[model samples]
Target chain A: MTFSDIPKFKLKEYSKAPELSSKTIAHKPVIIVGSGPVGLAAALDLAQKGHEVTILTAFDFIALGSKAICFAKQSLDIFDRLGIGERIIEKGVIWNIGKLFWKDQTNPVFQFDMLPVTNQKNPGFVNIQQYYVEDYLVDALEDMDNVDIRWGHSISDIEVRNDGARLDVDTRDGSYQIDADYVLACDGFRSKIRDSMGLDFEGRIFEDNFLIADIKFKGKAAEQRPSERWFWFDPPFCPGGTALLHKQPDDVWRLDFQLGWDIDREAVLKPENVEPYVKGMLGDDIEFEREWYSVYTFQCRRMNRFVHGPVIFVGDSAHLVSPFGARGANGGLSDAENIAWKLDLVMRGIAPRSLIESYNDERIMGADENIRNSSRSTDFMSPKNEQSLAFRNAVLELSNDYSFARPFINSGRLSTPTPYHDSPLSTVDNDEWDGGPKPGFPCVDAPVNDNEDSNWLLEKLGNDFKLLQFGGKAPESDLDVINIPIDSLAAQRYDAHHGATYLIRPDQVVAARWKEAQADDINGAYQRAIGAA
Target chain B: MDKFNDTVNISGHDDIYQMIVDLHADGNEEKSQKINAKLIIAMINQIGSEQIVKEIIEMVRLNEEKYNPRSSTH
Candidate 1:
């Protein structure tokens, strides 16, 4: 079905607007701005952890855009933790292979499997409309009584006080004041909070514009086509341009064509202009219908600091990368998961407030990685000077023939989880581990037998600190412990040769691991993970 | 003997060297320079190792200093 066929989900109006309440200012523990996927994910995460959250968004209904269709495996795992993974995986199209073509060649120069590591709980990537993700998060948030989603509420002004943050929220009828201990700005790239605070989002802006046309194929043609990402450089359809095609759910195909720097945006977006490119790629005989079309020039800019006093930036508000890598929403979800657990601990007084500082350090590293990758992809696709263009063309030309030159052909580097190996919260490794996720790396998932029934290692970890011990009994401690047999798949994936023990953080990141677990060392690592050390 | 020990990889040595020599055949200095620049970039990408590339760059710089001394604007 097309976008027009789907009905917008109108949010229920607040029974009593915060402005109309008796109190001059309503106080909340955590207030998240914008109800997009990132904001909603953060809200659901905090609420699931038993933290009271208030979501303030200006839109009363779900936005009708097919924005951010590719959700990576790490993001899907995050969604699984947030209680929406199964539904999304069921509805979304899963793809693991991507093919890159050069010039007029119908055959691909190279194809890559996004998931080099096999047998994980989630697939390499899922292509679902961003609205569905938002809807699922909102549905999960609505089920909890602790989450108060204030629709039609927009933050006009914010004050970062020594104690907390005070937001002047504007509604359709009136405005209200909300004093929140923390404010999460998941609002997209032009974040009002970032602007009001006078924070600089500095980075490189790419020079080419891409026209995105999400089209739905009619009849059996859609099902017959391969469900893999296909990218072309200088094809017969659009010469001297790059084109990308991704298969979304409901037979919807997202087609992006790089329109040169100097072109009429309005003229290109017109159906007459868009139809030619579509027909050129899909051929003249195929039947199709346009769902959505947009022209966007992406920038790789980000705030130097994501955390400012009582207010914190998440998702697009924190940083933005070019759309080539599909890192935008996926990276934002990581940010949400990163901050949610820290905030949960801080709110419960289980961890010190200084733990929140690690969020800045880690997510900034993640953002910089995304920026570096996307910027290189952008430079490869749209060379700035004649010399660069010659190099790009030389690579493309040589890649068609030589196997060695194919590695230089950069269409785009797909998004993956950026490991936080240098995080301050991670305890340095003293044990000699030949394999397995190192400190601050996201834990690997593997199949294991739980009481003669099959189970995934990641799902069993839950959203709290756990001790994954292999072939040995962990010492008595308050932390949850899971013992795995030495011959198990998880043991092999984790490279637990001789009774290894791992200290996993609440976000499923390996804080530390040891050949042998001692009570004092385990406690010290746990303390360091929670920023107590 | 140490210089000729040849720890570095130069697989398909003669063919690759011939291709590089052929690139300058009957070409002007400007065209040859452009070809060299592109070739260097492509080779660097082929190398794919920052440490090795840096070592190669330093070796080339030292060779230029020893063999081709800089002459003043005379």
Candidate 2:
């Protein structure tokens, strides 16, 4: 759908919830706040596993604007598991190469290719509006019987106890209380739930303000533009600042112009003021209309801990990072993926509650990495002081001449899946192995033969604990076993010997690996992976 | 009169500054000064470029001379 055709703040109809007396209060197994992408994905995951989930949100509609246009392949894989991958891939624009240009330079300084592997199931990144992703996820959630998504329900008060969390939610009719076994806060950056709990989101706020405008241009000229991420340190078109151009589906493009902190925000947002900037970049020949516009300041911050007793923060509620790397929604989706399985296992009594602690450890590390990369990107793009400016200019200048200096030019590192190398659940390697994913890393997808059927290795290993034995006899175990031939891509990727075995976790992360298969080793690894050992 | 690399080498000065601040957190100024001096020497050795080291030293000296409390009008 075109940008103009997309509805703006189209609120869904939410039936008024019954008034609650103290005795009539309902206790839910899981209560998710905010109907954003993270909450919707979490609810769907928990519900698909036969758990009841209640989603409470103040707004009934999906987010307005094309706010968060980029979705990483790792996130798409998670969405694939959630049953919306095909729809998202169909709707989103896929691209991998990004060109970075220096100020007043005619040619790009550096270019990066995110997905070097052509055989992967998903592309490196897809550019789709955030609202469309939420819409697809919400549609999926509506079909499930185990999920109850309550719209227009604002959370006014929250109380956390040892056993569970009590939330006082305000609806259109009246207010009601919900006693939930666990609370997942998918609320946006300005989270009231986090504030009520006295948690602090601590980090730096950049002084630069970026104006994002989603513009739609019809006909031949728009179609001819390269469908890749284009970033400029300073162009003659937009002097003294940075600008970014990203193509979305349906003849629309997202343009971001960095306006220094001192400019008048209201005056700069005017159509007249915005037109000149667009005209300067694209020339007067192209006829385009601005679909949406917003001014945003970058902030890199996160809570000290994600898990606070029975209440846990997910997505933007837990952490906020600068938008340079497209880490916001993609990071939130990863949070949902990390927490959903742990919460499901805990709720089903399959694993201890302590399993959730690893979610905090892993996601916190992910957040810190994102913050560090984004902070560096911001510093390079908008130098804070004279020394930084000098260094950035020198890098830009030298990048033209020397290939070694090209690495120093940081536009945005771009988002990549965070590797949980130091995770507590990952078993330390005991034997020497060649080139493959180490323990604690997410499984890389490769083509494999499953019973004469060609399938992706990741497709065969769904969201479950499985033991993969490459070129070896299948050991007797309670876990599902997948034995592949010696010469397959799976075997090659794992650097597998005749009897090498890998213990894959429910989240598709390699928990442990052994040079030789042993039933005892597999059992021990499985137990430790699920937090039983 | 040494010709250095004439290229930007040190990035993330804030992080380096923060590390030094953390190192001097014990409130021992004399010890901190000694540690800073040792660190400079170690870094210079690691860099292994006499011209670059001399240029850096000159740059720091110039900044110190310009911004020192005794030299400031206020």
Candidate 3:
């Protein structure tokens, strides 16, 4: 949407703490450090499971810019569980195709479609401004009675004890102290909690700077441009650098121009300087208005560990990556989903505390994959040395003629859910199976007829431990079991010949699978999945 | 006479030279030499032409002899 058209969310001031006295400290079950997408999602998830959650945000309002515009399908599915997926889809710009171009080339070097299937609930990707996402999440969070969101309350210091954490908060009324059973640092990239705790993120910071500009171009010319991700390597419009174009809602277009290492930052950001670049890309005929602009340099860095005793980190506080692959926000959302259920289980004493360690283990692997992919894309887009440049040029040149060279073209590898194949929580496969989600992989959605109504297979699984029995009668168990006929799509996706069963986790990841289900084997797998054994 | 009896086609000479300069930008002579040696081996492997590699070696040897101050030709 246009900058003026974007709704400005009002920031409210929280009242002074009631239980904060010299002798008594306000105690909470859980305290989330930020009210952004990750923190809000985590709060909603935990609150839905009957846990009391307190969210502490420094500011009352959402982000100003359309910062993270691309949301992957996996994140959308996670949002679906949080009850905001449909609304986001309704307002977002959905597209699956990405076209990559070489410098001044009339034809695209290569093109990719993220998802070809139209029967799916969510598209491959959607472009929605970050502020709108936060606004919707806030609305969802307000409906839950168990969630307490405190605005204008900033943490000045943090003491992470073995049992819990005590935070020093500053508010407009007065400074107060609050103790929490568990503390989550969702404070984003420059996390004050992480800094106060002396935690450091160790990784590489890229030297190149990119200027991101959001512009509103309406009328006939704007309508003529296709709604697809267009990436150019050293385009003529932005000579000697890279350029990216994406279509956002409300006639607002996002443009990213790569500026080399040595440039006058202030001079480059001026409207006078940026106008020529925009004009060159759109030509002299089209008219546009600058909505917002910012200069940023990205880094691929993450904390060594997400969990530290009673305090834990999630989202950007735990990991940070370049925005090329749209992994920054999507990865953070995954972290929230991963941690919420595990923390809930641990808090309820349903699982051992060690179960939370898997959050660190699995999310770190996910962050590493994102970092590697984004770093490679960055290197390809902005080659550090001559050899890499040569290789990139060769790939670009050959892609024009040879189909084999198209695969070598390195634009941003879009975000995908990281399959936790090596996670200790998953039961190892013991039987032969065909195409389907294996252990530690996300469960694929399939259309199913449940209770005489057409429903998604994922919807039937719900938010708890369940066993899917295919091609046979479900065995008796305390856990919920769904029986699908042999000819069903669910059976085919599970590769069930007669009696295949799958144990699904609360977050909808396949924990274990087997050709046949036994009570002891199923119990053992369930126990292992929850870290009881 | 063919200067090097080379069958391999080399393009982007200036880019290659700039790359070499960039590689040595740190001013580490020994490391640069080692990197150059590794690069030569890698290029030879990529070219996959033993005869062309041999010719290149012979050309380098002759150039070294011609430039050597103590040689009779000098």
Candidate 4:
């Protein structure tokens, strides 16, 4: 299907925060600043956990432009937990194969399947425009009575109190003060909350610019092309640079061309200048209309610490990375999930405030992993020096004949769930295992049957701390227990042959696993997982 | 006839190459050369074999001689 017209979103006008009778300043349990995917996800998770959430955003409407187009499987699973996964998957173009071409070769020098371990409900990735995700999340949030999304609200100033933080918000209606028990700074790269608090990030700013040309082709050519990620390194069309092509829903395609640091941004962004490059890739005979054109430079940076007093930074407010790995949005969603569950426990007095410290430690580990991978990809794509360039060239040159060198030719390492190997929240393994998800790793999903209906194991796990017991009856405990037979795919994936039991955290991370469940050990590990030990 | 084991030895080869390339990001030839010398010594210690080190040095010298005869070290 060829869609020539760009999708238009309805922009909303600002509304005032409701006036309170007793308190002049409105007190909110949680005030999340920013209406992006991260903020929305956090608000949804928290609201579902039975907390009142007020999400404030500067923009009145869904974001324009097909930004952050690739949604990883981990992100899809999170969206499933949020109840919008089906809608996203329905609208998105599912792709598992990525073809990497070197130079003008018609055949790919290297190809990869994003999902090595299969039988999961979600694919390796879904190429959907970011606006659709935000719009759907906003729709879901509107249905919940506890989530109040305030449009056109921006924080002008913030005062950090020992108990919580007070925000001076500027809205279209007027200015007001909001005393929030917790403030989630999900604001983008230029976060007002982070800036107001006099906090900054420690990271590297890559020295290259990329021009994104989102276009829709006419005729049958657009439909004929496979919906797979196509990347070209030093192609004849854009010599000495990298080019990426991804297909989004409604026949909208994203074309990213890496322009070196020396080019004039103004001239390069011109339609006349960009048309030739588009024609070079999709032959001159193919007719296409420009939907969106943008020029962007990226950085890999994160705050020294994500947590500061009662105010916590999430999403781009906490960390930023080059867009190569699609880690920016995916990592932010992980941050949202991580803080949402922990913040819920702390708010309910089930766990101490110090439990939030683990969020900082674990997310920092995730951010560092993202930065390291993104930085390496950047260095591989845009070589800093002649020596580095030579190494890159050697890797590419040797990849044609030698299979060993192909792994080194990194166009971009696609996003994967970061396993918190050294997370303090995890209870280390007490028993030896051959192959299964270890503590501090996200749980693997497998097809399972509930009664006669088919479902996923993660779906059954939901967003709670549950005891997954294989081939055993429900144990006597306050924690939720899910029992399954040992002869299932889930048991095989979890290596539950000898009746293994796992303690799954609220965020679906395996906190601890045992060869056999013991009451004393389960209690100890559960306490440790919740930061109560 | 002689058989050769043409297997890739380095695990995470790209990262090792990146680390080496990053060391030269400043474009300081002398500093990189000295650092590389130190790295080689440290790696030789890790290898912990006199005969293997000698054989590698000879192979490198031969390759260097074949590539750039005028700049050869011996």
The number of the candidate with the highest DockQ is 1
Give the native contact fraction of candidate 2: 0.00
Itemize residue pairs with steric clashes in candidate 1.
Answer: none
What shift in Å separates residue A301 of candidate 3 from its native position after superposition? 0.9
In model 1 chain B, the worst 10-residue window by lDDT is B1-10
DockQ of each: 0.25, 0.04, 0.04, 0.05
Model 3 lDDT per residue over A330-398, tens place: 999989999898999999999999998999899999999999999999988888876666667666765
Q: What is the TM-score of chain A alone in each candidate?
A: 0.97, 0.96, 0.96, 0.97
Off by over 4 Å in 4: A1-8, A19-23, A449-452, B1-74
* Order by TM-score, highest first: 1, 4, 2, 3
Estimate, for each residue in A106-199, the C-alpha lDDT of model 2 and write its tens digit: 6788888889877778889999988889899999988988888888889999999777999999876778888999999998898989988988
Winner on DockQ between 3 and 4 is: 4
> Clash pairs of candidate 4?
none
What's the TM-score of every candidate structure? 0.92, 0.87, 0.86, 0.87
What candidate 3 gets wrong by more than 4 Å, as runs, is: A1-9, A20-23, A116-118, A449-454, B1-74
What lDDT does candidate 2 reach at residue B17?
85
Name the regions of candidate 1 deviating beyond 4 angstroms: A1-16, A452-454, B1-21, B26-50, B58-74
Candidate 2 docking category? incorrect
Tell me how candidate 4 scores on lDDT: 0.87
Give Cα distance to truth, residue A487, candidate 1, Å. Answer: 0.4
Say which candidate scores most in TM-score. 1
